[model samples]
Target chain A: AQTVTQSQPEMSVQEAETVTLSCTYDTSESDYYLFWYKQPPSRQMILVIRQEAYKQQNATENRFSVNFQKAAKSFSLKISDSQLGDAAMHFCAYSFNFGNEKLTFGTGTRLTIIP
Target chain B: SQTIHQWPATLVQPVGSPLSLECTVEGTSNPNLYWYRQAAGRGLQLLFYSVGIGQISSEVPQNLSASRPQDRQFILSSKKLLLSDSGFYLCAWTGGPGETQYFGPGTRLLVL
Candidate 1:
């Protein structure tokens, strides 16, 4: 079984500043996918960024990027130029590379973008 | 563009009452469907997932059961509800296993 851990339960960042949310996972599977999801008060899950275990290069999507260290089993998300809209609960999830593998999520980190 | 719709946006029921939540997807076929439960201030927990019609995989052993009657429709049902079942239920779909999932607005169920 794979377990995801988000050591930071709460985080705050000033507007326009950068923030990094930490995530670590324990998985024996060599082929897997890692994701970061955001859920605001609306309770809708939004995909932030993704990283494949095989990819040595990190994944970046606009302001959101991931620092994936496969050897360390760490995948952290970095939000650059953070805005008030970035205030939400962020979750780190893991899944297999195969068909319909269910996602295992971390406890979550509540992010507050301070203005 | 694809979208997922989950119904009754909010629901309130008494303990031991029966429950049913419907979820449907549009603009996609043979997609993987999933049901998740979110407790207050907690991350989404995978309850059930379906890869095809009449096939359901339950991740957590709970009072709820899921059924995929059609390729694009998934339903979560409970014969008798429990207070522990009170939470936000979210429906999600993905193009494949490794693909990112798109989630619905979620149904807020409160069992009193």
Candidate 2:
């Protein structure tokens, strides 16, 4: 079974600053995918960024990026130039490269954007 | 683009009562659907997933059940609701492998 861990229960970042949310996972498979999802007050899950274990270049989407350390089983999300709207509950999720499509998600980290 | 929808944004039921929740997806066909439950201040717990119509897979042993009657419609049901079942239920769908999943607005279920 794969398990994702987000140690930081809560994180605060000032507007226009940068913040990183740490996440680690336990997986035996070498080929897998890591995803970061954002859930706003509306309770809607939004994809922030994704990293493929086979790719060492990492993944970047606009202001969102991920530092994927496959060997370390660590995938952290970094948000730059954070805005007030960035406040939300962030979750780290994992999926296998093969037939299994189910996503295993971490508890989550509540991000507070201080304006 | 694809859009997923879950009906009855909020539901309240008594213990031992029956449960039924519907989820639908539009602008796509033959999508893979999933049902997830999230407890208070917790992450998502995948309850069921269907790759095609009439195909349902359960992730955990629980009192709930799921059914997929149509290609884009999925339903979650329970014979008797329990207080522990109270939580936010989410519906998601993916086009295929390695694709981003689109989530619905989620239904909040409360069992008394």
Candidate 3:
């Protein structure tokens, strides 16, 4: 069994500033994948970024990036130049490389972008 | 490109009623489909997943059941609804293992 943890329940960032959402997971498998998903007010889940456990280099997607420490079992999401649209519920997910490919998600962190 | 569709977008059902949520995928064949439920202010819980037609895997023991009648059609159902079933239901699909799962618009289910 695998579990993901998001210590922060809520976070706020001023517009144009940067914010980091912390995430940790418990998994015995060495090969896996990590993901960050954003759910806005519309209630649509959108993929933000992804990182592979085998890769030491973090994943960056435009204004979003991840600090993935495989040894520490931590994968954190960083949002640079945060916009109002970035205000949403962020979730960290973990999945192994094989099997059913099911994702185990953290409780989630509600992000609020202040003007 | 692949796309997923879930409906009726929003649903309000009375307690003890039945449930049938449908999910369909376009532009792909034999994709892995999944059903997830998100309670209020919470993350997603994987309920069921199917790798192919007539193959369903349940992650938890619950009141719900899922079926894959066709390669691109997945359905989640329950004989009777419970208040606990009230949540946002999301349908997702992935091309293969280790692939990024794409989500549909989701269905907001309210069990009154």
Candidate 4:
């Protein structure tokens, strides 16, 4: 079984500032994928960023990026130039390359952007 | 482009009432479908998944059940609604294994 953990329950960042949300996971598989999803007040789950284990380079999508340390089993999300729209519940998820492709998700971190 | 849709954006039902939530996908064929529930201030819990029509895989054993009557349609049903079942239900689809899963707007279910 695999499990994902987000130690930070909440995070805050000033507009134009940056914030990093922590995430870690326990998995026996060496090759897998990590993802960060955002759920805004509308309750729509949106994909933030994705990291492939085989790739050493981190994944960055505009203002959103991830610091993936495969050896440490840590995948943290970094939001740069945070805006009000960035405020939402962020979740870290893990999935294997094969099988049913079921995702194991972390508890979630509520992000608040202060003006 | 592929799109997933979940109906009944919001539902309120009394305890012991029957419940049904519908999900459909457009512009995709033979996609993998998934049903997830998110309680207030919590992460998502995978309720069920289907690789094809009439093939369902249940991840959690609870009051809810799921069925995929058609390749692009998935339904989440409950014979008797429970307060514990109140949550935001999300429907997702993926082209194949390891592909990025896309989510629907989701339905907010409230059981009284």
At residue B21, give the lDDT of candidate 1. 100
Predicted candidate 4 versus true structure: per-residue lDDT over A72-107, tens digit per residue: 999999899999999999999999987577888999
Q: Relative to the unseen true structure, what is the Cα RMSD of model 4?
A: 0.8
Give stretches of model 4 more than 4 Å off: none
* DockQ list for all candidates: 0.82, 0.74, 0.84, 0.78
> What are the clashing pairs of model 3?
none
Task: List, residue by residue over B1-112, the lDDT tens digit for candidate 2.
Answer: 7789998999999999999999999999999899999999999999999999999999999999999999999999999999999999999998888877779999999999
lDDT of each: 0.95, 0.94, 0.95, 0.94
- Tell me what fraction of the real C-alpha contacts between chains A and B each candidate also makes: 0.85, 0.62, 0.79, 0.65
Candidate with better lDDT, 2 vs 3: 3
- B-chain TM-score, every candidate? 0.98, 0.98, 0.98, 0.99
A1-115: candidate 2 lDDT, tens digit per residue:
8999999999999999999999999999988888999999999999888888889898999999999988899999999999999999999999997664789999999999999
Please give the lDDT score for candidate 3.
0.95
lDDT (Cα, tens digit) per residue for candidate 1, span B13-112: 9999999999999999999999999999888899999999999999999999999999999999999999999999999999886788889999999999
Which candidate, 3 or 4, has the higher DockQ? 3
- Model 3 lDDT tens row, A24-91: 99999999999999999998999999998989899999999999998899999999999999999999
lDDT of 4 by residue, B22-72 (tens): 999999899999999999999999999999999999999999999999999
- Candidate 2: pairs in clash: none
Candidates sorted by DockQ, descending order? Answer: 3, 1, 4, 2
**Tens-digit lDDT string for candidate 1 (A18-87):** 9999999999999999999999989889989889898899999999999999989999999999999999
